[model samples]
Target: MSSTETATLSVPGANLSYTVRGSGPVLLLIHGGNGDANVYAGIAEHLAERYTVVTYDRRGYSRSKLDNAAKEYSLETHSEDIHRLLTELTCEPAYVFGSSAGAIIGLELACHYPGQIHTLIAHEPPLTHLLSGDEQVHARHIQENLEITAQREGIVPAIRQFATLLGLDQSNGSSGRPNVEQLERLLANMNYFVMREAPAIRRHTLDLETLKTVWNGASMRIVIGGGRASYGTFPYQCAVALARQLGLEIVEFPGNHLGYVHQSQEFAMRLHIALQD
Candidate 1:
């Protein structure tokens, strides 16, 4: 196994903690939901064998300490942090993989700072802005309900509701044991995610015009991806909608939303194939 090197960057409102391993073109992994850099540990380890895998805890999550805990989280700030990290870490443009909310952030980065990215694989970005009429209203209601639940009940119940809304709580009878440490870390970050990140994500609107400009110019290659089993879910639908709008192909990965966690090696292999020369 390649040794992991940890570092910190003093960004605007937070000191970001990140990890780097292996060596090749820089491939930065942006985690989603109640997660930190550790969420990509398995995928990073596999990808590191061929590429320099970089993973970081977004502002106010895990090891990334925030200067203002009460500061409202926004997609702009999240995207800016990624741009700063890439600019400080590499002279050349980097490949980026962003999951869920992280995927939304990647889209923002590609739209605003096209020069900083080579290719971006945005996996299941929950782009509610792409929806229309009834679907949009339905999505809004779900998010609003989640916020209310978190405020009234707590993070755990809110998360359970979230999973149920996405239909992820259904039993598949898979026998793998959960990682206790990862679960604890995820639980610890739930407060930040539920109170701040989720709201930010819900309010964000992707600039389709800017995205079209970048894609038309071929300045940045954007690939939409989703889990095969996650079809019909909001995130999967969002990926499909975005791909349809952009006239791009939607790449299917191994498992559901958390595929990279349980099927990391398989996901890594498919990811490498999708990113091949």
Candidate 2:
């Protein structure tokens, strides 16, 4: 097993809680909505064998505290936080793997600081704008409904709906089930996630024109990944559309949307291969 170390970094508006394991080139894992670093537990353990794996609670999630009153945040803000984190950890460019909304953040990061990343594996970024006319409209409608559900029915009901939206409701939770403590933490985080993070994700637009310029000029490689089990879903469609836009192939991985949580070992191995490529 790899060794583990946890620490906190104070960024401008928040103190970010992060964990490091193993030793090698850095591989930062950015989790999606309602999840903290704990979501990557199994995946980190496996990846740490070959890389210094960094998992962190994004600004308002888990132990990472906001220093002031809650305010609307943007994808660019999260990207800058990560930029500071990468600069603090290593002088060399690092690899990044981001799931769902985290993947959107990674895309934002790559756009602004292309030189800071060696390669970025963006797995299932749910950018509705990437979809076609009706598809995009329908996706946004679902996101709008999710927000309304969160506001009217509270976090639990909204989360249940979100799970269904992401195809996570189909999970038996056999491998992905959180323990009591983790469950409690996740539930707590969902409040901020539903109210703040989800909207940030929804509002973000992938500047494809800018991204093309970056991709053509930078050394950074962006790989889009989609889950095999998640095929035909909203997120998977977004992944496909993103790949099509970027002229990159969509790398299929094990399990569903939350594959890193449920199929961690296999996902890590596939990820290792993707990173090497």
Looking at model 2, report the run of 10 residues with the lowest lDDT sum: 169-178
Candidate lDDT (C-alpha), each? 0.86, 0.89
Candidates' RMSD to native: 3.0, 2.1
Residues 102-180 of candidate 1: C-alpha lDDT, one tens digit per residue: 9999999998888888889999999888988777788788888889998899988988888888867432222365478
In order of listing, the candidates' clash counts read 0, 0
Model 1 lDDT on a 0 to 1 scale: 0.86
Residue pair clashes in candidate 1 = none
TM-score, one value per model: 0.92, 0.94
Candidate with the greatest TM-score versus the true structure: 2
Task: Residues 1-277, candidate 2: write the lDDT tens digits.
Answer: 9999999999989999999999999999998884788879999999999999999999888799888746667778899999999999999989999999899999999999998899999999999988988878878888888899988988888788878876784332235577997677777788888888888788888999988899889998899999999997889999999999989889999989998888889999999999998
Candidate achieving the largest lDDT = 2
